[model samples]
Target: MVFGKVIVSLVSLLLLVGVVFGVVAAVRSRGGSDNKNDSVSSSMKSVTAICQPTEFRDACIKSLGPIAKNASATPKDYMLAAIQTTTEELKKSLEVAAKHNVNRETDPINHDGLEGCKELLKYAVEDLESAISMVSGSQVKDINDRVRELLNWLTAVYAYQSQCLDGLDKPEYKTPIQDGMVNATQLTSNALTLISGFADIFKSLNISVPDLKDLKPSTSRKLLEVNEMGHDNYPIWFPAADRKLLAAQSAGRVRPNAVVAKDGSGQYKTIAAALAAYPKNHKGRFIIYVKVGIYDEYITVTKNQVDVFIYGDGAGKTIITGQKNFAIMKIGTMQTATFAAVGKGFIAKSMTFRNTAGPEGHQAVALRIQSDMSAIFDCSIEGYQDTLYYQTYRQFYRNCVISGTVDFIFGSGTALIQNSLIIVRRPGKDQKFTAITADGKEKSNGINGVVLQNCKIVADRELFPVRFQIETYLGRPWKPLATTVVMQSELADFIRPEGYLQWDKVNRHENTCTYQEFANRGPGARTNRRVRWKNFKVLSPQEAQKYTAGRFLDGHLWLKYTGAPFTLGL
Candidate 1:
C-alpha cells in the first residue's frame, strides 16, 4: 500500500511542473503580441511627432522625449511635461529678476518695472499650475473650451515674459534678465504651438469637439419705444399716456419740470436742488433745463429718477464743477465723481462736467454713469485723473469731448463713443504714464466693452508741454477680461509706440485683455511696434464691422431717441 501511494505522488509532482512551464510560455507569447501594448507604443510615437513642427523643436524634444518613452504617457501627459518645463524656466528668470534691488523714490521707473515683472511671472506660474490641473481632470467632455482657455493662459505666459524684458529697459541690467526671459518665452511659445496642434490631431483622429459659437448676448435689451401715438405701451415704467410729452420736453417745445440757474431767476439756484425737486418714479421723462452758468455743486441723478433728461445751453457755457478728490476728500474712487448718473435711460446734452482737482489729486472722477441705455451728447467731461467713469450697463456718448490726465475715459460699461474727441492731458510732476480707455469687463461672456469710432485721440499740448506727452498710451486693461477696440479713429503722435500700458505693478490682465485698432490713422496708429500681446489684434476690415456703433451698441434701434448722430456702420 505504501509503494502505491509514492507512485501516485510522483505523478502529481510531474503534472504540477508541466502546468507551470506551460503557463510561463503562454505569458511570454502574450507579452509579444498584446494589442493594448502595441496601441500604447503607437500613441507615444505620435506624441513625440507633435513636437517636431514647433519653432523650439529641439527644446520640445529634449523636454518631452523622455516622457514619451513611457508607454503609458498620453498627449495630455506630454503637454503637462512641456508646461512644467516652461514654468521651471519662468521661475528661474523670476529668481534672477528678484535679485536686482531698486529704490522706488530714486529710480521709480526701473523700480516699478522690475517689481511688475516679478508679480507677472508669479501669476504666470499659478496660471500654468491651474492649466496642468485642468488637463489632468476630465477634459474630453468639454475639450474645446478647455483647449481654448489653455491656449489663452499659455499665450499670456509668453506675453508676460516679453513684458518682463520690455520693462527692464536699462541696458546694463537687461542683458542678464533678457537671456533667461528669452529661453522662457521660447519654451512657452513652443508649448502653445504644440497644444494648438493637438486640436487638428484630434479632428483627424475623429475626436468629438463642441461647436464654437458666440456665447455673448445676441440682442441688446430694448427699452420702451415711443410712436407718434399719445398712448403708452409699458405703463408701469411710463405712466403718462403721451410719449411725445417727453420728446417735446427734450426738443425745448415744452416747459421743463425744473430749471437750474446760479442766479435767483429759476426755482432752484443749484443743480442738486433741481435734482432733488425732480419727481422720482413719476414715469415718462422729467426734463431739467440747466441755464448758462457755472454751477459749482456735486450732483447725483438717483436710480429712482428714471428717464431723466438734463440739458444746458452749451457745453462750455453751462458747466457743473466740483473739487472732490482722492487726496482731499479721502473717498473711494467712485465717490469722487463731480456728477453721477445712476438712473436708467438718463440723457445729458450740451453741458460740461468738470473736476477742479488737478493731476495731483490722483483719481478724481468728473462724471460717472451707472445707468443702462443712457446717452450723453454734445457734452464735455473734464478732469485730471480717472475722469468719465462709464461704470456699468450700456451707454452711448457722441459729439462729446473727454479730457483727463490718466485713464480719461474708463469704466466697465458697454459704451460706443462716436464722433468724440478723447483728449490726453499732461501728467503731474510725479506721474509718468497717461492711459486712456481703461475698460474693466470682468468676464468672457460679458456684453461689456468699449468701441471707439470716428474719434480723435489728441494730446492737450496747450496744458502740457510736448515733452510731457512722451508716455501716453491708447488704453490699458483694468480687469483680466477687459475688451476695447478703436476703429476709424485719428490717433495723435503723443500716443506711445507700445500703444497700451500695463495695468499696474502686478495684474494678470495682459493674457485675457483684448485690445485692437483698425483703420486708425496717425504716427501713433502704427501697429508695427505695438506690444505683442497675444490677444491684441489689428483687425481686418471685415472684423472691424462688428464693432461699429450700429452693431456694437445696437444704435440703429435706440439712438434716434437721444437725438445723437451716429454712423450706422463702418
Candidate 2:
C-alpha cells in the first residue's frame, strides 16, 4: 500500500511538472505576437496559478465565499479578489509566453483554453444547486456523488488550465518583456486568485455542510487574514498613532486632565482627521478624543486600522452622524450613510452617530460596520430608514441606542447589544416598513446576523399600538445560510407575536439558516406562541458558546480595546 501511495504521489508530481512545462510553452507561443507587453505575461501567471496543485488552489478559493455572501458586496469586489490571488503564476506564465512569442487572448489557439474551466465551473454550480435543493428537501441520496462530481469538474478545469500555461512557454513570451506585460500578468494573477478562492468556498459548502462549532476557528482565521490584507492597503484608523499606529497611551484615555482640543497646527483637527492619520497595520493602543459638538460627517474606517479607540465626552453631546444611502444619493449613485467602519479591533465610546436625513425617503443608513472584533460603548446611532447597516462579522454594542424605522438595524454581521436600547421608530403615513435585521447572505460563516442582549425594544407610539402590523423580523436570511440569535433580550409587544418575517418567496429555505434564542423573557419573547420554532433554537450550554463574542465574531483577537460586553468562561 505504501509503495502504491508513493507511486501515485510520484505520478501526480510528474503531472504537475508537465503542466508547468505546458504553461511555459504557451508563454513562448504568445511571445511571437506583436503586442509584446505585460498583459500577456500577466495572463500567463494567472493561468499557471489556476492550474497549480488542487489543495493550494482550493485554499485560495476559500477566502472569497464570504466576500460573495455579503449583499452589499459588488462585482468590483469579485474582480478584486480574483486578481489578487496569483502574482507568481502570472509572472512565470508571461516569461514563458515571451520566449515563444504567443499572445493568449486574441490568439485562436489560447482563446478556448479557459473555456473548459469556465464550463466546468458552470457544471459545478449546477451540481451545487442540486445538492442544496436535496438538502433543503431533506433527501440524502447522491449528495456525496454530487460533491465528487463538483470536485472532478474543478480538477479537469485545472488540467486544461495547465495546458494553457504550457502554450505560453515559448521564446516570444520569455523574459525581457515590456513593463506593461508584467503589470497585466500581476493583475490577472490577483483576480484569478480571488475568484478561485470563492469557487473553493462554495465547493466546500456543496460538501457536507459543517456545523458552526466545528468551523469557527478556521473561519475566524480566514477573516483575520482578509482584515490584515485590507489594512495593509488602506490605513483607515489611528492616523496620529505612532510608528506602530497604536495609541501612545496604553492604559487610559487621552483627555482626563488635558484641554487639548484642536491644536491650530496639530496633525489632525477633527476625529476624522485623526483617524485619517492612523496607519493601517499598526497594533497596540491608539486613541482619538472628540470634543463636545455634534460632528455631522460620513465616517468609514476600513479594516486596516487595527486596535483603535475613539473616545468622547458623552454619547448625547459627542455626536458623529451622516446621511448617505441608495435613497439619498439618487439610487444609481449608491451613495448613503454617515459612518461606515470596516476596521477590526475598533472601539467608540461616549459618542453618537446620526443621520439627519429624516423619514421622508429611503433615508438610509447612519453607521454601516463591516468590521470584526469591534465595539461601541455608550453611543447612540440615530437615523430614519436603514439606520445601522451591520455588514458582516462579529461586533458588540454596549449601552447603545439604535433608532430607526423600516429595517433600520440590518445587514449581515454577527453582533451583540448588551445593555443597549433598540428603539423601533414609527413609520410615517407615507412610509411602509420597519424591520430590525436583514441577514443578507445566509450561508454559514457569511452573516451570523445581529443579536440583542439585555436590551429593551420600545417602538414609537405610531408603531406601538399595532402589534404585528410592523413588517419586522428578528432576521431574514439574506443568503440561504444566515444564522442570527438573541439571548436574554426583552422584546415589547410591538415585536409582533410572530417575531420573524420572510424574505419574499424566493428565500424560504426551511432549514438553510438558523435563528435562535435563550432565556429571552418578555411579552414579545414568548416563543411558545410567537416566532417560528423551527428557526428559533433554545440552546444548551455547549451550543450557547457559538453566540459568544470571542467565538462568534473573532473578538478574542481585538475586543480588548473595545469596551463592550463579551462572553467569558468559554
Candidate 3:
C-alpha cells in the first residue's frame, strides 16, 4: 500500500546486512577501490545523500567512512559495508559474552535468558550469512529482482537482534548488553531507512544504475537437475527414507527413531526423555513419536538439536500443557513457552501445545519457535495471551488451530498461517478486548509479519454469545511497523466492524503499521467500517501476491524439501 519509487534503494539496503564490511574489506585486501566513478567527492556526496534519509544518519555516514582509497564505491557497496560491519560488531560483543556463558550463570532465569540471547545472536549471524550469500553470489545488478527475498532476510536479522535484547530483560545484565549493542543497532536502523531511498540517493549522487533485466537461472540447472525428485514429489534434499515416510498414508507404516509413551510401553516414558535421548551430531531427520497422553511439562528443543521432527497421535489427544505466565512466573515472556523450538528444520505435527495460564496471566506462551525453515502442521496451540511466539526466521503453520484472547499470535518472525483456524476466546472478567494477533515488526521494510492466508477467524463458542458486548479485533500493532494481512480468509460476524484494535487512543501507529486485507469474505471482512489508518488497505492482486504463502515465504525453494504442502502464489 505504501509502495514508493525508492523501492530500489529499500531492496538494496536489505542486502547490506552481511556484505557491508565484507565487501569493503574484500576490496581493500584484494583490490583497491580506485574506479573512475568512485571518486572521493562522489563517494562523500553519495554517502551524505544516502544517509540523509536514514534514521541513524550520523551512524550511516560514519560507518560508510571517509576512506579516500575506495573512490569508486557505489551506494550498494556502502550498504553492504554497513551491514557486514554491523554483523562484525554484534559478533565481537557476543564473543565477549562468552566469559559470562550460560553454564556459569547462577540464576535459572538468567541462564535461560542468556542462552536465548546467545542463540538469537547465532540466528542473526545466520541471517546475515544468507544475505551475504545472496549479494556476493549473484550479479550486483540483479539485486533489484530479489527485493522481497532480500527484505525477508534483512528483516529477520533485525527481529533477531530485537528479540535478543528484549529477551535479556534481567536488569543486572541488560545494561551492559544494551551498551554493547549500541553500534550494531544503530547501523541496523540506518540500513532499514536506506531500503526505500535508493532512487533518491542515486539521483542526488548522480550515480548511474545498470539497466534492469529479468533474472534467469543457469541453463545447466535446467538440464542437470529437476527441483522435484521421486516422480514429482519431494525435493532432492529430502532423503529417500524421509520422503517415503512422509508419503506413507499412515504413521503405522513408518518407524520412528524414538517413541514416547506415558504408560512406559515405548522407548521413552516422557517427551522430555525422548528429546534428551537425541543422538549427538545428528545428521538427518531425528524423529520422536509421542503416543496419546497429556504430558504436563515444559520442553525446549535447543539449538543443538537440529532437524528435529516431533509428531504425536493427534492435536488434542497427545498434548503438552503448562501453567507458566508473567503473572505467576519470575521468567520473561520468552521463557513462558510450553514448548520452544530453537533448532532449524523443526517440524511438529498432530500435537497440542497449550499454556493453561488464564487470561490474567499476561504473557503466557504455548509455543515459541525461533527455528528457521520450520513447519507446524495439524497442530493446536492454545492460550489466553501471547499464545504462539512466531519469534523469527521463516516459519509456516498449516491446518492448525490457534486459539487465544489477546495478542495470541505475536512475534517478529516472517510467518505464514494457512488453512488454519484462529479462534478468538473469551477474555477475563476485567478484559474488554480480544485481539487475535500482534505482528512485532520493528523495522519498516523488515519482512517479519503475520500473514493469514485461506484461514478462518471465528469467535469461540463461549465468547460468541457475548461478542457484541466485548470489543474483538483482528489485531493491534505491537511495534511501530507491525504488519498483518488477512487474505482469502473467512472472518466470522463476531469480529468488530473496525476489524483492527488500535495500539493506543492517539493513533500513533496509524501511518507505520502495514495492515491489509485481500479478497477476504464474511460479514466481518467488510471494509466499510474498518479503521481508516493510513497504512491499511484492500490490496490488489499484485500486492496480495506479496503476502501469499509461496511468495511471502519463498516456500517453493525449501518447503518442498520438507514435504509441507504450500502454495507458491495467490
Clash pairs, model 1 backbone: none
User: What C-alpha RMSD separates each model from the true structure?
Assistant: 18.5, 17.2, 6.3
Q: Rank the candidates by lDDT, best first.
A: 3, 1, 2
* 1-570 per-residue lDDT for model 1 (tens digits): 000010111122223323333444455456674555555443334444666668877787778767768765544566578888888888898898888877766665566567757866875786688777766664333332244345545645654565565456677667877876776777787876665554344455464333212222212221232222234332222445225675564566767789988888888898888888866458567889999999888888886787888999999999999988866555546667899987778999999999999988988999998776789999999998999888766689999999998887887667889899988888788888888888876544334678888999887766446744458888899878779998889987777888887798798578889999899998778999998888999999877877766556555445666656677678
Looking at candidate 1, the ten consecutive residues that score lowest on lDDT are: 1-10
Model 2 poorest ten-residue lDDT run = 1-10
Which parts of model 3 are misplaced by more than 4 Å?
1-53, 66-80, 92-119, 125-153, 167-176, 191-216, 220-253, 505-507
After superposition of all CA atoms, the RMSD between model 2 and the true structure is: 17.2
Give the number of the best model, judged by TM-score: 3
Error of 1 at 159 (Å): 26
Best-to-worst TM-score order: 3, 1, 2
**Model 3, span 7-70: residue lDDT tens:** 2433444444234334445544465456666544534544565467778888887887754238
Residue-by-residue lDDT tens digits, candidate 2, 385-429 = 778776545578888898877767766556666777888887766
**Cα-based lDDT at residue 364, candidate 2:** 68
